[model samples]
Target: MSGSLTAIALDAVLEEHGLTLQQLAALCAVDHDWVSRHIEEGLLTPSQHGGEWRFSSATLLRVRRIANIERQFEALPELAALVADMQEEIDDLRRRLRRAGLE
Candidate 1:
């Protein structure tokens, strides 16, 4: 989110498939240092594989979602809460629609 579309792509690849930090940077065509900084900043969290960082597809997707929201809102905390509420509302609506056989 703080970065660019490249960051979103990197996040997507990581989310879709488990990847190491190095692998993720490579996929994004960026430096490992950049990725490390982002991770340290709490923008990313990679799983550990034998003390090595690994990423899951879900995490990447989450990162992408976070980034997208941040880009739109410019403030992560507010956007994150808004997104959560929106998702809950959507889920509730879907449930009601299903009960009505209109889903």
Candidate 2:
């Protein structure tokens, strides 16, 4: 866990099938209803495999972030999703800059 190789291996494992709804809910400390509502509201989108929804690691992180923002500010789902979108954009931009050796 302290090494880059360990992180890479764990990421590879997670990439195999992504996370189930139950796993994502539990890990994010949110309930199934919360996740379902987000899906209904278009805040989160999960891929389907074998007729079941599967969330990627990125989705898990997004859920956690939105939950945090809602809890901290009592924001509605729409507002929270917007904030999460902005935050994700910032993160993506930072990564791009870093990759380009500009950050």
Candidate 3:
């Protein structure tokens, strides 16, 4: 074991999230390979160590946020502009809903 205390802390964080890589990938709307590669490259750190793979809820959350942004706003400049316009409209609707106490 790397360190008993460190392992214990990692386990605690995993317990709070209770997600597997597949689940996280689904939530992020990205391929499992991408997540795995990112982890292997040390771009993301796992919260817990499984037999072969480690998982970090915090890292997965960040990935999901990025994936959502990318999906909503495609990479192309034209698509990005359209997505931004749509997002602005959505934001306005959300604000109106909140003010109406229906959010």
Best by lDDT: 2
> Candidate 1: worst 10 consecutive residues by lDDT?
58-67
Q: Mind giving the per-residue lDDT tens digits that candidate 2 earns over 1-103?
A: 5798897786676677889999999999999999999999899999998999988878988999999999999999899999999999999999999999999
Where does candidate 3 stray beyond 4 Å?
A: 1-17, 69-103
Q: Which candidate model has the greater lDDT, 1 or 3?
A: 1
lDDT of 3 at 96: 100
lDDT score for candidate 2 against the true structure: 0.91
Cα-based RMSD of candidate 3 = 11.4
Name the better of 2 and 3 by lDDT. Answer: 2
The residue pairs in collision within model 2 are: none
**How many times do residue backbones clash in model 2?**
0
Better of 1 and 3 by TM-score: 1
**How big is the positional error of residue 6 in model 3, measured in Å on the Cα after superposition?**
27
What tens-digit string does per-residue lDDT give for candidate 1 at 1-103?
Answer: 4678877886576555578776666655557885676678666668777888887755444455555565677765445545745765787799999999997
Off by over 4 Å in 1: 1-17, 25-45, 81-102
Clashes of each: 2, 0, 2
What's the distance in Å from true for residue 70, model 3?
Answer: 4.3
